[model samples]
Target chain A: MADWDWDFTWEILPRLLAATVNTLLAAGIGYIIAMFLGLAFALAQRTPSNTLTMAVREAVEFIRSTPLVLQIFFVFYVGPEFGVVLSPWVAGMIAIGLHYAAYLSEVYRGGLENVPQGQWEAATSLNLSTARTYFRIIIPQALPPSIAGMGNYLVGIFKDTPVLSVIGVAELMQTANSIGSENYRYLEPYTMVGIIFLLISLPSAALLRSFDAWVRRKLGMN
Target chain B: MSYFEFLVAHGDLLLSGTLVTAMLAAVSIALAIVLALTAGLMRLAPAGPVRWVATVYIEFFRGTSLLVQLYWIFFVLPLFGLSLDKFTAGFIGVGMNLGAYGAELVRGAILSVPKGQWEAALAINMSPLTRMRRIILPQALVIMLPPWGNLLIELLKGTALVSLISVADLTFQAKQINATTFMSAKAFGTALIIYYVMARFIITPLMRWLERSMARKLGRA
Candidate 1:
């Protein structure tokens, strides 16, 4: 029985904070990948080709239903068997990015759906290409409504970044695990991980909610 | 195929692991339902310590990662002499996390049950508890089921983390078999399909049925 150790906590704070940067980088890179992939998925599902739509829809559903931790393992562990070996960081980012992309595609689908038939018709009437319609007219309108859901998943991807620790990503959770194993003091490191997540995620969630409202107002949709 | 041979060899282990995963999902989801209702009610309580406590629980559980929480409860609580087996810690970690999210859905559903219903119950001189029991809760339950279905799936996925705690769930079994056989594709692939089946064929349809039955019972079908 050891009591709470402040001295040990101070010694470990810098190490934990240093690893927080890696965690942020992993999440940041993963979020960007998800954003692009999710939009592609959302668009793929809406294409005129029924087969493509069905395939993409099934892909998204399969991804969403399965556990992300397993997906991370699959990508990292199984990739080598197919001669598609990737580092832990690369595999982790792809797996998590793919998992959240499934969720984000749904969010995008909802936003894209909310854009009226009139917008499409008007673009057609104006003789605009599909690309011009999406880029110049529709996507901007779709974006404001999507912002809140997108932000939630952004926070979601961050929370899920810890799963990457399993693959030796050296992110916050993995770093904390090493610290605990090294010092044999699980309490401080684990508790601090929880605290760091709360401190980062809570305010960001709040900010995103307000930002969503602001965007909606700015777009005159609300 | 090599995968079929692998399965033929290790099918029993995978089957047992699937059973463990199912058990974990069922127990944790049950716990989550109870906790969600309790906290949801507490959240709607007029401003006070109860509401404050519920809010804090929801925020803390929702804000942090479940893996971190599971590690804390399983790894740290023993230091304070409150040791729990992996299953106990596993379900608690997931149940609490899901409950926090479910609490919001519960509150939202209850609040969504139009204002007039509460006013009407008040006009009829119904007690508050009776109003909730007889009037509000029944309606709110139907509204909440679809979202609760999603949460249940999330709970099922989250149980994978219990493997990290060495719970011998489907994921752990897959990992173990992989270590020995070095057949990562077959092991993890089978595990993924089993999970997908559980989610889509089992949990999703089951939830859809419940939602429909509840709607019919409430005369809203």
Candidate 2:
């Protein structure tokens, strides 16, 4: 068995921890963008005009079907060609956010579908405006069931932050890669990154599960 | 160069890369299914130690990022006098990662098989191994196939990550062409379309067929 070197792990612990902050920030901002944009896309698909709805649906499907890493490379590399230069950080966030938005839109669509038809009829009978009906009747009920799905993706995006390393985002994975390349010892660095991810994901997963259970109970679901 | 001219010139390279990507995804998923089935069954084992081992394997692999795992297997293991080729390492890393996820699906499907079925198998005096092999596993396979198909598509997309470790898959080939021609649009654009076609034309149809066949078999029974 190979004896792990504790001194090396201890020395690099702070650096990994520091990079983890960037990872968390990226996940936070990306998730926020995804949440809002996902709603926009989902709403766009349900727009009154058939042409607008079809175009939006196709665009979302295309984005959803492609690999996120390739999307990141495309946005990061192609943006400058189109006279829209973005830094690696911005590019990474946009790519991750857009990719996840396509997914979250589906979640939102499912949540919206779960809203019973009678609720909309009741809102109509009350002479509510379309916007008011959506805000007061539909969205309030649709949002909660989708919370668990959204939370899962939050953890997913957190886990996928390492992919941003391909664009040199200086997140935990990038930091580990550079450290390994410089020192020629990947054991400590990669293992440290794995530990850091477990530290975050395992706890978040447990919390999400409990939250899911609590939500189910609140909804009177078994 | 025009996008058309660039694509025409580099068409052969892109095609070969696409072929490699498909082959890698197919092979890795085949291996992953076998691993997942075994580990997943072990997860439901009556023995406490067996279940613990399976849980540890799944959590440890699923919790970490695939990129880190790929780098470790491809780059780090050699330091400890255990070395694998780049292609082997890529396959192992992706297979293990997907296996961790697939195992959960397998376990869920198995458990979803009604308790009455288990009781029936036991009442018939079937051995535990025979019951699983003849009854539980067959039903679980049908239930597991649809989700496994989705995971297979995910695995296909994931193979692009192998390029980072020098596997020369589709993404790597596109990067190579882009570097030489500086036609990022054509190179990457072609790669993306190829992936889309594979997923839409091939994987999706195959999954539908599997779902139909499984449904038919269940109905016949």
Candidate 3:
């Protein structure tokens, strides 16, 4: 077994940290896409058209059932033949975002479902337009219950960012891989990447738990 | 080549790859269930070191990314003189990570069991071990079945990471075909369809049947 090398560890720290920003960026951008797309998906299922609902629901199930990495590959590779060429970063973001959006839509669906049927009836009784009912009355109520699941997926999206590295996105995992290969030392880089992930995710999870509680209280839901 | 031709040429390869994928998923689920049971029981134990240790293990595993864990085991463990073959490393990573999630489900399911059931068991003068083995676990098992089924699907998808570690799973075969033929559409599209079929057709039906059987066994059907 090779002895530990502190100097090599110190030398690689800066590069990994730089890549950390890119990892966060990818997660953040991907999350933004998922959050909006997920809402659309959740709402689509509740629409009046049977074909639209079934089609979207099946799409969500298919997406959720498959692996995220394969989706990343599909988007990156298969898009070209359809004349939808995209850079690695762009493709990675779409794939990751779409994958999580499927999961989040379920969360959204649950939240929306819990918004008592009376609320919908009340909105109709008020003669409010459909858009106004959803955006103004219904969504505000759905927001609190959705916060916890949304927060979980936020962390989930953060952790899955490493998969983007497979497509050469220059994120932390990719950076770690390149660093290890360049120096013929895989131990330090991979460990550092793990440490970085743990440090961020653990606290954010705790924070999210408290945030969920806080949102509930603010909405007076107990 | 057309997607049909691609499948005709490489159907056997694809099927064998899927067999490996299914095996990986099966072994990993078994491993995860064992770890989850152990750690889950630990987390619920009377407040002590075991509980604390379980808490730490769950948080540590759940917090870190899976790919990093796989890479560390596959790449870095050998530096410390513990060498695992690639398949062993693959399932261990996927199993242990999912096990953390499973542990929570276990904890939740157990807690969901009515406190009255425990009190009744105590009134019957059942030994602690027997009480848990007979009453608590049976009730908890029913409550946990649905979530466990979901985790099985997740476990199946997780086996895909093994391909990255160079395991010859379904995904590895797809990537291989894509590389050779540059037929990204036929290769990846076909792979996607197969995955969708396995998940939607096979796993979903299987889970539904299991859920129904468990509910019936529990007399809640």
Candidate 4:
């Protein structure tokens, strides 16, 4: 059996912690992109134009059905051929951000659907512009219900950050792989990565669930 | 060379890759269902430690990254004198991960079976075990199906990660073909289409059919 070395784990701890910062940053930026892009996708699907609705629906289905890793590979490798050379960081952000956007769009759609039909009618009767109706009235109502799903994806995107390591983004998983190769001990680095992920994921998931409940209560949606 | 020419050369490689992906998905999903049922039952047990064990298993798997879990089994387990072949590792890793999520779905479905049904089962002098097997599970299976369809699709997408472990799955073949011909678009693009077709055309319809049949069994159709 391979022995676990305490000394080796301690030596690698600092580097792994540093790489954790990169992981958090990637998840943050990717979430921001997903939030906005997903909103745009959700709104696009609701437009009066049948063509726009159908196109957006098909696009969302395609993205949701495929794997994120393949999408990352496609953008990173295939982009150069079409005269678009991006750094691994930018490429990873775009690919992951877009992939999650498709999922978040569905969540947004569910939230949007939950808002009663009368709310829209009430907005129109009050002479509010369509934009105002959505932003000031309907979106606020939709958001409380959306928070739980949004939180799940937040954790999901963070967990998926390691996949970015495949394209060489120097995240936790890549760092662990390098450390293992250098020290000829896979046990320490890999185990360390799992514990770190568990530590971050479990607490964040709990926090998000509470936050979701809190948002619903504050909005009188409970 | 053009993308079409690249496809022409690598078509057989892509097809074989598709086959591996299908096989991997089939194996993992079957294993996940069994684990889900066992864990789901444990979660509802009256004993405290048994319930706690189920909770820990579900949360632990659900909380961590599947990639790390897969790598841990593939890399670390071997160091500990339990070296699994790639297929076995992939099966255990993905199956266990999906099992955690599926257990929750199973629990939810079981709980959704109305309370009066349990009372009625008790009145008929049925044992708790018989009530679950005969009365509760039949209804829960239909209720469990729609979400299970989504989980099954997620499982299919997850199988792509097995390629990272050198499983010669569809994603691996795409990479191999790309390496040989440097036709990144054709290689990855073909793989994408094949995946889309499988999810959209085959797996999805099959799940829907299963769901409908299960619903009919409960006389809900």
Candidate 5:
């Protein structure tokens, strides 16, 4: 049986810390993509074109229904066959981005739906153009309620960055796996990964809650 | 090979894989429900220490990724002389992870019960247990069902990760078939479709039926 080794833990901590930076970078890029694409998906569902709405809705459902790792494999492996090759980083970002976009779109849909119909009527009465109404009025109202959900997914995408390791993205999980294989020590690296995640997620979750309330108060929506 | 030929060849393997996935999901969800109830109730406990334990459990589980948790259980535990089989590790890892999320849902639902209901139970001189079983839980069950539906689907998707630890689930079989045949689209595509059908058609409707029946039982249908 193996016992814990403090010296080895100290030695690998720097490498793990470097991988953590990559993990955060992956999460940040993925989240930026998800936020915009999610809005597109959410708004597409509300469009007057039945085909567009159906297509976007189906796409979201399909993505949500399937596993992220499978999608990652599909894109990374199968893309070259279709003449759209990508780097591991690009492929990982696209897969994770799209997967979470489906979820974030759902959050946006709920927020959009929560806005009263009378608000739209009021905007119409005020002679606001469709784009103006959406950008100026509806979006501000929609955002306060969606902040908490959006924040959850922010942390969610962060935690899920580990899946990119499967595609050899050099994120924290991949780094930890390699470290484990190299030293034949699983205990330290895995525990450190969990600790890193908890340390970030717990504080961010609390902050998001407070931020949610702050947004509501700031918008005077309550 | 044609898709039909592929199905004829590997259909049984995939089906058996599906069964394993289902069994993993079932065992994990069953265990999760038990854990969620205990922790949820403990979260409402008057004692600070008990509540703190429940909070820590939920936070630690919720904060980490399920894949990491599974790896820790499957890989790290053996170093400590606690060797678990793939199934047991998958079961515990997934169960505890989902339980943390479910416990929050459980706590939220119980708290959403109206204050009047508790007052009325008190007025009727019912015991706390009786009041909970009869009055509070029924309504909370209805409130809990929809989110539980989402969690169930999430748990079902999470079973795919168990493939990493050499569990013979659908994802593992997909990888195996793809490696041997080099049929990336055929193998992985089929796995994706199977997961879609199971989640969208089978498990989803079943969850809806459960939710509806619970609502009907409470005359809230």
Candidate 6:
């Protein structure tokens, strides 16, 4: 154990910190894309047209069933083959966004299911339009329970940002791999990478838990 | 090469890779179930220290990324003069990581088994071990299988990471074939289809069947 080298750790600390920013950027962009795309997919599924809903559901399921790394590689490599060139960052965002959108769509579906049927009926009785009923009565109540699951996926997407490294996105894990390859000291780089993940994930998990609790209380489930 | 020609040439390699992936996922899930049960039960232990130890183990594993953990186990541990085979390292890493997630599901399922059942077992003058073995465990297993099935699918996806550590799984084979042939469309498209078939046709249906059987046994259906 004494073979562990502190000097190497110190040397790579700055590089890892810089790469940490890239990881955060990837997670933030992926989350924003997933958040909106998920809502879109959910709404698409709820659309009145049967053909559109089936197509959307099948697309979401296909994305959900496949591995994210494979999806990342597919988008990164295959897109260029089709004459649709994308930088690694853009490809990674699209893959992660599409992948998580499938999951978030399920969350939204559950949230929508939990919205009391009477609420829709009551809105209809008040002669509200379909759009007004959704915006005023349905979405407001349906969103909170889904927040916990959505937050979990946010942390999940954060953890999974390492896969972006495969496409040369220069994230924290990629930085660690590069540092380890350059210095031949795997301990510091990988351990530091793990620590960076723990530092970010643990706090975010706690915050999500509290937010979940607050949402529950607001819904009068407390 | 055209996609059709590429598929014909590399068909056997892709098949073997898919088999390797399925085998790895099966082995990892098996190991994960055992580890999850042990850790989950420990987490519910009456003794504070035992519970604390389990909690810390689960948290530490769950808090970090699986790739880092895999690299640490595969690359760093050997530096400490304890070398592991590539397959063992991959299996253990996947098992340990999924076990952390599975432990939570196991704990929740066990707790969901109903308080009165435990009291009823005690009232029958059964030994605590027998009570758990004969009554609690079987019911918990039924409840746990559905979530465990989902975790199993996650493990299947995770097996792809083993390729990074030189495990020669499906993703690795695709990458190799792609590098040689530059037929990314054929290689990855086939790989994606294979994954879809496994997850959709096999695993998802199996999980639904398990859930249905459990609900039937519990008379809840």
How badly does each model clash, as a count of residue pairs? 0, 0, 0, 0, 0, 0
- DockQ of each candidate relative to the true complex: 0.85, 0.67, 0.84, 0.86, 0.78, 0.76
Q: In candidate 1, what are the lDDT values of residues A31-87, reduced to their tens digit? A: 999999999999999999999999999999999999999999999999888888899
Best-matching candidate per DockQ: 4
B125, model 4: CA deviation in Å? 1.4
lDDT for each residue of candidate 4 in B1-221, tens digit (9 for 90 to 100): 77777767888899999999999999999999999999998999999999999999998889888999999999999998999999999988999999999999999999999999999999999999999999999999989988898888888888999888999999999999888877888889889989999999988899899988888887889
Write candidate 4's Cα lDDT for A1-222 as tens digits: 898899988999999999999999999999999999999999999999999999999999999999889999999999898988989999999999999999999999999999999999999999999999999999988988898999999999999998998899999999999998997889999999999999999999999999988877787765
**What shift in Å separates residue B90 of candidate 3 from its native position after superposition?**
0.6
Deviation from native of the Cα of residue A90 in model 5, angstroms: 1.1
Candidate 4 reaches a DockQ of 0.86
Per-residue alpha-carbon lDDT of candidate 2 for residues A1-222, written as tens digits (9 for 90 to 100): 355889988988899899999999999999999999999999998888999989988778777767888889888888776788889999999999998998899899999989999999999999999999999999989988998888889898998899999999999999999888887778889888888899899999889989988998998877
Per-residue lDDT tens digits for candidate 5, residues A159-182, read 889989888999889999999999
| Ten contiguous residues minimizing lDDT sum, candidate 3 chain B | B185-194
Model 2 chain A lowest lDDT segment of ten: A58-67
| TM-score for chain B of all predictions | 0.98, 0.96, 0.96, 0.97, 0.97, 0.94
Interface RMSD of candidate 5?
A: 1.2
What TM-score number comes out for model 4? 0.98
* Candidate with better lDDT, 2 vs 3: 3
lDDT of 6 by residue, A1-222 (tens): 637688878888999999999999999999899989999999999988999999999998888878899999999999878899999999999999889988999999999989998998999999999999999899989998788898889999999999888899999999998898888788888888999999999999999999999989988976
Real contacts retained, model 2: 0.59
> Interface RMSD for each candidate model?
1.0, 1.5, 1.1, 0.8, 1.2, 1.2
Cα error, residue A74 of model 6, in Å, equals 0.2
Candidate 3 per-residue lDDT over residues A1-222, each given as its tens digit? 867789999999999999999999999999999999999999999999999999999999999988888889999999887888999999999999999899999999999999999999999999999999999999988889998999999999999999898789999999999999999999889999999999999999999999999988887888
What Cα-based lDDT does every candidate model obtain? 0.94, 0.88, 0.91, 0.93, 0.92, 0.89
Error of 1 at B83 (Å): 0.5
Across B52-89, the per-residue lDDT of candidate 1 in tens digits comes to: 99999999999999999999999999999999999999
Task: Give the TM-score comparing model 5 with the true structure, all chains together.
Answer: 0.97
- The parts of candidate 6 lying over 4 Å away from their true place are B216-221
Tell me the lDDT of candidate 3: 0.91
